[model samples]
Target: MSLQVIILAAGKGSRLGRALPKPLTELNDGRSIMQQQRDNIYEAFGRDVSITAVVGFKSEYIVDRFPEFNFVYNEQYDQTNTSKSLLRGLKASSKGGVLWMNGDVVFDPIVLKRAASIIARDQSMVTVNTSSVSDEEVKYTVDAEGFIKELSKTVRKGALGEAVGINYISSRDKAAFIHNLGVVHKDDYFEGGLELSIANNGVLMEPMDISDLYAVEVDFAEDLERANLFV
Candidate 1:
């Protein structure tokens, strides 16, 4: 089966407060966050997988800087959250399952490869990259079977996992999923819709533990510095 990737790059990076979008923020390796993610995905999945980046905020800057990667623009990005951005990319992708990821995260290529493997084995499967939770990171509640029961960045209880901002979705289910996604509350994050779909619509989700793998996602200047050290 062919694999496709949808990179959500529309966020304003308000936490970073940089002139550049979060995706365009500089990494320790001197490459932009977008460049690092794109390169990492390509390296893991190769040319067989179709990759489309969903860009907004500073769409022109992204297009001009990385002309090689395919891009789809989301005009309403300023008013919405990640769910909308993901829906836009899902609509534009070709007929195949997709690997959905956040533009702000930095992760090992092995995580992508592992997710692809899981998706290949089961078309209904969605994968979440998880790690040992820290006080500062977002957390997830999983059932006894390890399926994600709930996810929150701020919930104080029952949080044993952290979402690494990666997911897999089948093409056959994309339309229905995206349509249902349109009804999500405006302020909800992309994962909110995903958790709803998994619970209410019976979407199959799997977890991939990546505690051994290390990558730094930049949400603040401190995180940027951490990423520099890891990269």
Candidate 2:
């Protein structure tokens, strides 16, 4: 089946304190963060991959910039968070497995090559950065058989690392994920859905560690600097 990808770009990104959407923030190389993400997706999966970006805050700006993407507008973006935005994106995507990422992430293309193999096998997985474990980012711990168990910022006990923005859901698990995302409370991150699916639906998701490759979700000035060095 052809690849379907979703980018969750519906937030105001108030943390950055910028007028522009976080995804549109310009990198040192002159590419917007979303544009760089698009390039990375193309490099890994080719241009034919079907891409849908979920837009809400400043939707028109992102919509006009990337004419290549199919957009799903989240009307409640201002009142909600990633769980709601991602629910819309998943609903808009094809029935096949979908790969998605936070629009603000700047990642190396090599990461997606590994995703390709997992996507081929129709296995669900979340990409992780084993090197850093910050209190602010979503952290994770695997279950007994190596599937992701607990995933959230609250994970303080045995966090393997941060679940770096990028992730995949197989066709077999997509509906379950969608259901969980829908039931999650507003303001909950997308990780809440994943955790729910794992706990409630028996979905098994592997953690694909990518600490060796550079992937930074730009949330602040310091993160943008770190992302630029690798980009």
Candidate 3:
């Protein structure tokens, strides 16, 4: 099936303390983080993917910067979080398989390839990294059958590792997935909506281990520095 890619780039990235929005931060060889993601997706899926980017916090700059994408502006981005932006994007998404991603992450193209391979078969998935675990991470745990049991920042132990903030939903599950997202309060993270869908809606985003790949979400100033080095 054809795929639609939704990139959430609405936040101001205050923790990074950068003039550029987090998504537009130059990370690798002067290419912005979003550029890298777009390039990687193109390399992985080629013409099968269409991109819809949700932009806020200098929305015009982001829109103008990436004219190739279909843009949706989050008018209340200052008052909301990723979940709200994702809901908006879902309303704008076409009917197909969807790859949802955060804009702040920089990752190898192989990560997209790996995710695509898994999603093609299982239809729903979340990319995971078992190589690094931090107390502050939003960890995802799986039962023995490889089904996701929980996803939260508070889980301090027995987590495989952090979720890469990349998720896939098959076209068959689109309506239910949107319903799952819609029931969430605007204040909650997108993950909260996602968890709801898994428990009540049966939207199974099984964990796809990608510990061998290099990926990093640049949240803090130090994370940005580390991302540049890692990329």
**Candidate achieving the largest TM-score:** 2
Count clashing residue pairs per candidate.
Answer: 0, 0, 0
Error of 2 at 155 (Å): 0.8
Q: Give the C-alpha lDDT of model 1.
A: 0.76
Which stretches of candidate 1 lie above 4 Å from their native place? Answer: 123-131, 134-137, 154-156
> Which model scores highest in lDDT?
2
lDDT computed for candidate 3: 0.84
Candidate 3 lDDT over 1-231, as tens digits, reads 567899999989998887867899987588999999999989988965789999889888888898889988899988998888998898898777788899999987899888877767747888888888787777888866788878878776678888888888777777777887778877777888778878887777778888898888989878878788866
TM-score of candidate 3 to 2 decimals: 0.94
List TM-score per model, in order: 0.90, 0.98, 0.94
33-112: candidate 1 lDDT, tens digit per residue: 88888888878878666778888887888888877778888888888888888888888877767788888887776776
lDDT of 3 at 149: 76
The candidates, ranked best first by lDDT, are: 2, 3, 1
Candidate 3: the clashing residue pairs are none
For 1-231, candidate 2 gives per-residue lDDT tens digits of: 679999999989988888978999999999999998898889999999999999988899998999989999998989998999999999888778999999889999899998889888999999999999999999999988999999999998998899998999999999999999999999999999999999999999999999999998988889999998987
Task: For model 1, name the residue pairs that clash.
Answer: none
